[model samples]
Target: MSSDRTASHLARNLAALRHARTLTQQELARAAAVPRSTIANLESGEGNPSLAVLVKVAGALSVPIDELLAAPRALVRHWPADAIAPRHKGRGVQVRDLVPEPVPDEMMELMDFEPGAVMGGTPHLPGTREFFTCLDGRVILMVAGDRYELAPGEVLAFPGNLPHSYQNADALQRARGVSVVVLAKAGV
Candidate 1:
């Protein structure tokens, strides 16, 4: 999927889901705790949505976060970096989705970590697990109060129900890595 198509899918899916529940734009916005304008922009495919916004909307709709972002798909989807890979920026980090369509129970993302970048994540539902593999540089992952240092080619796996955080360990170099999250129960 290209970026344009991704936006179109989001617009279509959002509107369809909202209508399916007989929700007006304002109603859905209230449910999602977002401004009506945000919902309008998202449904019009005219604005960038942060991960937090997507999460809130999905929760309000009683759907998975991926349900809002994934494109309709057949088997054997291919995500070319230049096309469907929209880099989602955080305070000091960058992330790209690696899957064009949502899998039954999984999420994959590529992360670029600038020096001093830190990301904190709340606990996922029970039975969820997350894995991280360092592709370049180093990072310190803190999960459930346990800190683990990961270098290139190293990997770490842990239950996602634990509060977690990560930071680039190298003060002068950026780090890159892949993160895979598995939900024990699909679409939960």
Candidate 2:
């Protein structure tokens, strides 16, 4: 979406969420540590809130930041499964959960990498980006010949076109993570 559309959408959602919570403009302003005029301007669709301001608004609304910026659920497209393809013989790289269908230009997959599983170097398709978050055990993700270890709650996003792979650090525990691969629908 264009930045203008995004800003307007966020402004509307913020205004709706704020009103739904029965918060007055003054109340929201105090809670978010921003001026009342800022909230008013955002609600009036005359201003753009920075990410930091959005976070503050999220805190004020007691919701995740993404909740305030998501498109309407009905309008979100299904994520195609074909975009995610993994090569390996290890136990930790099993596909667990998919977001049902391809979500327009993006795909999300939850992969469970079994301990002792490792994938050797192989470059990803050009124009692709991989985003992973360590959900369980430590995982070693290699990108462009460099190794990086990730712990639970940690996230890594990089170009998929580079030679990349992931290794399970231990066999005693399961190494699980979520890999969100984003591919261009046409330009790619």
Candidate 3:
């Protein structure tokens, strides 16, 4: 690719990856051991970064150098169910990431709670919000010291920064739900 095109790809990918990781320019610069101004300039597509700089940035972002210069991906992608691994929580809880990659400021997860199972919520940055919809069976959500009984088709919204947890209400049935978390924007 032409130098200009490569620079453009680098700028876009760098910004996207940084956002997905919830890192500010300053934080990324610190992690990459680069000057903060360099990060700013690169993201603005105004710098011809050295190979050393590229390597440092890629290492900090935990991505390959080629990913930094690769062309934008297609808008639509498919992730097979079996291809995604389920994260088992305490007891009989299973959580699966619905997206193949981390989305900027957002996350979607599929949750399954076997009978008598309980799972603690993972808190996010301040201002983050969580939405949970019980798709089948029943779930009892505990948030901010309050208990909520959710039946199938019921939805609950709460601040994700606060303490929360979910439990299967029934002792003999499995409960399934979807959780969507929207993270707070950096410096907001």
Please, what is the whole-model Cα lDDT of each candidate in the order they appear?
Answer: 0.84, 0.76, 0.92
- TM-score (C-alpha, index-matched) for candidate 3: 0.65
> Best-fitting candidate, measured by TM-score?
3
Tens digits of lDDT, candidate 3, 44-151: 999899999999999888788999989999646677888899999768999999777756568999999999999999888899999999999999999999999999
lDDT of 2 by residue, 82-135 (tens): 755554435446764466632434667676777778865335567878898999
Candidate 1 wrong stretches, greater than 4 Å: 1-79, 87-89, 186-188
Q: After superposition on all CA atoms, how large is the RMSD of candidate 3?
A: 4.7
Between candidates 1 and 3, the lDDT winner: 3
Q: What is the lDDT of residue 106 in candidate 3?
A: 85
Best by lDDT: 3
How well does model 1 score by local distance difference test? 0.84
Residue-level lDDT for 96 in candidate 2: 41
TM-score against native, each model: 0.56, 0.49, 0.65
The 10-residue segment of model 2 with minimum total lDDT is 96-105
